[model samples]
Structures are given as C-alpha cells and as structure tokens.
Target chain A: MKENNSFILGIKHGIPICLGYLSVSFAFGIFAVGSGLSVIEALLISMFNLTSAGQLAAVPIITGGGGIPELALAQLIINLRYSLMSVTLSQKLGKTVSALDRFWIGFGITDEIFAVSTSKNKSVGRKYMFGLILTPYAGWSLGTLLGSVAGNILPDSVSSALGIAIYGMFIAIVLPTVKKHLPTALCVVGAIAIGCAFKYIPMLSRVPDGFVIIIAAVVASMVAALLSPVSDEESEQTDEKEVNTDA
Target chain B: MPSMNFFFHLGVMAGITYLVRMLPLVLVNKKIRNRFLLSFLYYVPYAVLSVMTVPAIFYATSSPWSALAGFVIAMILAFFEKSLLTVAIFSSAAVFVTEFLLPIIQ
Candidate 1:
C-alpha cells in the first residue's frame, strides 16, 4: 500500500518531467528521422538509451557509419557524467532497496530524476525512486513515437522551431539552482564559455559535441568543487537506511 | 546495407552507457567521505546542461532570431520559477510565432 502511494507521488512529480521530455524527445525523434533512421529505430534508441545528451551526440556518428570504437568512445565521454550521479545516488539508497534494485535505479537515473530524488527533505527509498522514474521513462518513449510520426508531416518552419524545445528543457533544469547558488550559476557560465570557445576558436572548432560537453563539464565542475565545497550539513548522509544498505 | 554495422553501433552505445551508469552504483556501495568530490559531482549536471544549451540553442530554430526569442522567453519563464512544462511549451510557442511572423515582416 505504501509503495503504491509513493509510486503515485513519483508519478505526480514526474508529470512535469514527462511533459518536458515529451517535447525534447519529439525534437530528437525528428532529428533521428532526418538522419535516415526509421521511426522504429529512433523509438528504440530513445527507449533503450534514456540519456538525452548522449543519444543526441550519437546521432551524427550513427548516421556517419562510424566504427564501434568511435561510437563507444563518444558514448563514454558523453554519458560519463551519469557514473558520477549514480555514485552520489547510491549513498542515498536504503537497505530496503537491494543491490539489484540499485543497479536498476542507476541505469534509470537521468539529470531530472536525480535532481528530484535528492531534493526530497527525507531520505528517498526504492519505492519513490521507482515511482519517480516510471513516468519520465514512458514520456521519453512516447515522445519519440510522437516526434517520429509528427516530424515527417510537419511543415518545415514548425519543425525547425520545435528543434530548440529540448534546449529549453535544459535551460529550465539549470535555472532553478542557478538562482539560489552562486557557485552553480558560475559553473553554468564557465561551462557555456568553454563550450563557446570550442565552437568559435579556430584551432578547437573541429572538436565533436560529445568531447566538448565532457571537457566543459569536467573542468568547470572540478573548479567549482574546489572553490565552493558544500557545507558539512549538506553532505551529511540523510538516507535513514544508508548504513544498513552497505552491509 | 549490412545490418551488422547498424546494430553494432547501437549496441556499443547502449552497452557503454549502461556500464558507466551501472558500474558506479554496484561498485560504490559506501558513502563518499570526500566533500570536494561530492561537490564536484553535484555540479556536473549543471555544467553539462549549460554547455549543451548555449550555442546549440542558438541553432535549433530556422532563424537565429526565432531561437533567440524562444531562449530568452525560456530564461524569463524559468526565472519566475515556472514549471518545466510551462517553460518549454511557451518557449516553443514563442519560436513558432516568431518563425511565422519573420517572413511576413521581411
């Protein structure tokens, strides 16, 4: 009964995430189809690969007929951030959630879900995380289906405008914390500057998007972490079940 | 078209992504004691999102002006603490309207 309630709550919280994802994934679906992948292939990619940025980065390589080594390397750099996220989230899981559960959650954790689960005032459990993950998961897959079908029939101007919707979602994610935290705001600015340099600088302009994101994220975050280490209170493990889970 | 190449590329992407995510969860069962590293992890999402949004957002629409308008609308809506759905929808609408009106004005 309790699991059901938490799952419902997760779905509730996920509603907005689902809505945001629908638009973004719709954009991606269009991009994928444009790149020559069939709707089923695009849909499968979105369903199997939930990480938005990583999948977007993969499109060009997949379309280019790049070798597996290049594809894997790109995936590694672009998706590496999730490894860090899962590590942080692992500390928050309680004993009730098993190692197998953690593995499942880890695979499902995206930026939005991680942000929502961690911000809870109380320790998050498997039920809530599961609840939280389910909606966005559906939203992404459904959005891909919608985007793929819709993209082909849409007028060029409308499709072109819809292209930026995913970026808008990214903006929404950062804006909330950016308002409250100086370091977070600066980190964003620094990352953007780094990204721009890669795009504009003659020598570095040829760098791939995945490499650029990896570099910006690593360099900017390392500097922020050093300069603005969070207060001890914030770092205290709040998950009530964290201790028992480790055993 | 050899089906092997297509499946091979997708498989590699999926496998690598899944491994990176699952490995950390399975391997790091203990709480991290290091504050700096924790803070660094905390900022990764923000940095990643920021880098991906800028420059890229500028190119998302047919016209730079339309994309810029939509991006500005998104920032303003986000600044007011609008829900993600609201921000995205309104911003996309902003782009749509701008794209529609641009040729008329020209």
Candidate 2:
C-alpha cells in the first residue's frame, strides 16, 4: 500500500514533465522525418533512445551513413552526463531497490527525471522511480508519433520552420547556465569558435559532422575543466542550489 | 541505403546509451571522488549543446535570416531563464513569422 502511494505520487509529479516533453519530442519527430527518416523510423528512434540531444545528434549520423564506431562514440560523448547523474542517483536510492531493480531504473535517468527524483526530501523507491519514468516515456513516444504524422502531412514551409525548434530548445538548455557560470560561458564560446572553424575553414571542412562535434565538445570541455576544476565543496553547494531551484 | 542495416545502427546507439547509464548505477555505490572528471562531465553538456547549435542553427530554416531571428529570440528568452517549452515554442513561432515575412520584404 505504501509502495502504491509513492508510485501514484510519482505519476502525479510527472505530469508537468510529460507536457514539456510532448512539444520537444514533437519537434524532434518532425526534424527526423525532414531529415529523410520515415515516420515509423522516427518513432522507433524516439522509443528506443529516450534522449533529446543524443537522438538529435544520432539522427544526422544515422542518415549520413555513419559507422558503428562513430555512432558509439557520439552516444558516449552526448550521454556521458547521464553516467554522472546515475552515480549521484545511486546514492539516493531507497532500501526497497534491489540489485536487479537498479538496472531497470537506470533506463529512466534523463536530466529532468533525475532532477525531480533528487529534489524530493526522502530517498526514492523502485516503484516510485518506475512510476516517474512511465508517464514521460509515454509522452515522449506519443509526441513523436503525432509529430511524425504531422511532418508527413504539413506543408514544406511550416515543417521547415519547425526545424529550428530543436535548436531553440538547445539554446534554452545551455544559455541560462552560461549566463551564471563564467567557466560555462567560456566553454560555450570556445566550443562555438571551434565549431565555426570546422564549418568554414577549407581543410577542416573535410572532417565529418560526427567527428567535428566530438572534437569541439571534448576539447572545449577539457579546457574548461582544466582551467577551473570544481572542488567537492563547490560541487555540492551547486547541487543543492540546483535542487532548490528545481523544487 | 546505409552501409549497415538500420537495425544495426539502432542497436549500437541504444546499446551504448544504455550501458553508459546502467554501469554507473549498478557499480558505483559511493560518490565519485575525482574532481577533474566531475568538472569535465559538468561542462560536457554545455559544450556539446553550443557546438551543435551555432552555425547549424543558422542553416536550419529555409532562410538563414529567419534562423538568426529565432536564435536571437531563443537566446534572449533563455538568458532570462524561461522554461524550456516556452523558449522552444516561441522561437519556432519567431521563425515561422520571420520566414513568412522575408519573401514579402524582399
């Protein structure tokens, strides 16, 4: 009975997240179809990989006929943050979670979900975690289905306009943090500078999109990390502030 | 057609993504003590998102001008710390309106 209550609470907490994902995933679905994927193909990608940025990066590689190593490496670079979130989350798991349960719960560790779960005052249990994941998963998959169908039917002009929606979402994700954090601001500027060089310079323009993204991200992040390594005390304070703001 | 079958690519993407999330949760019972690694991980998302957004964003729409309009709107709203959904929808609207007006203006 107690487990059931937490599960219900989790679903209730997930409603706003579901609504937010619907629009973002819809844009993704249209973008994927515009990039040459069939509607079903777009839907499949969203269903299998419940990541916005990772899926955004993956679609280009997939359609461009990128190799397995390229795909794997891109996924690693794009989703590496999840590994860190999972580590932090593991410490917050309630005693009800068993070894096998950890594997299943691991699948739902998106940035939003992690924030919601961690923001709670108490440790989260397996049932609550599953409940939290279920609603957003459905929202994400359903939104893709709607958007993919819309992409096929919508006129070219409108669909083309929708193409910028994802990038707008990307900007929304990065800019607020950049505004507050100097290292992060420099990281964005550095990455953008590298990105432009690869796009414009004749010799560097020869590099594939996958490798260019990887190189810019890795190099910029490495430089930022080296320049101002965050100590444990500062990291914890930031985490608390993030959770507080999230709540 | 892709060099390999589509399922193969899907498998690789899904497999690698899942493994990265799963390994840490299942194996790591303690807080990560490595500072540089943590900082690098902290900065990765911002760097990756920035690299992907610029240059590419300017080309996302039919007109680079419209894309720029949307990008500017998104950056402004985001600087004020608007919600993700709000920023995304308004930016798309900005693009739609800008694209509509461009042909007439020219």
lDDT of each: 0.77, 0.85
| Model 1 stretches with alpha carbons more than 4 Å out | A1-20, A34-36, A64-74, A88-102, A112-132, A232-247, B1-3
In model 2, which regions exceed 4 Å deviation?
Answer: A1-5, A231-247, B1-4
Q: Which candidate is the best by lDDT?
A: 2
Candidate 1 C-alpha lDDT tens digits along A1-247: 1222266787787876777677778878987876678888888788888988788878877887655666787678667767776777777676667878877887788766766666555566778778788998999999999998887889987777677777776776678668877888999999999999999999998776667777888899999999998764543332221111111
Query: If you superpose only chain B onto the true chain B, what TM-score does each candidate give?
Result: 0.88, 0.92
Residue-level lDDT tens digits of model 2 in A29-82? 998888888888888888888998899898889899878888899999999999
How well docked is model 2, in DockQ terms? 0.73
Residue B32 miss distance in model 2 (angstroms): 0.3
Instruction: Tell me the lDDT of model 1 at B29.
Output: 66
TM-score of each: 0.83, 0.94
DockQ of every predicted complex: 0.59, 0.73
Clashing pairs in 1: none
The CAPRI-style docking tier of model 1 reads medium
Clash list (residue pairs), candidate 2: none
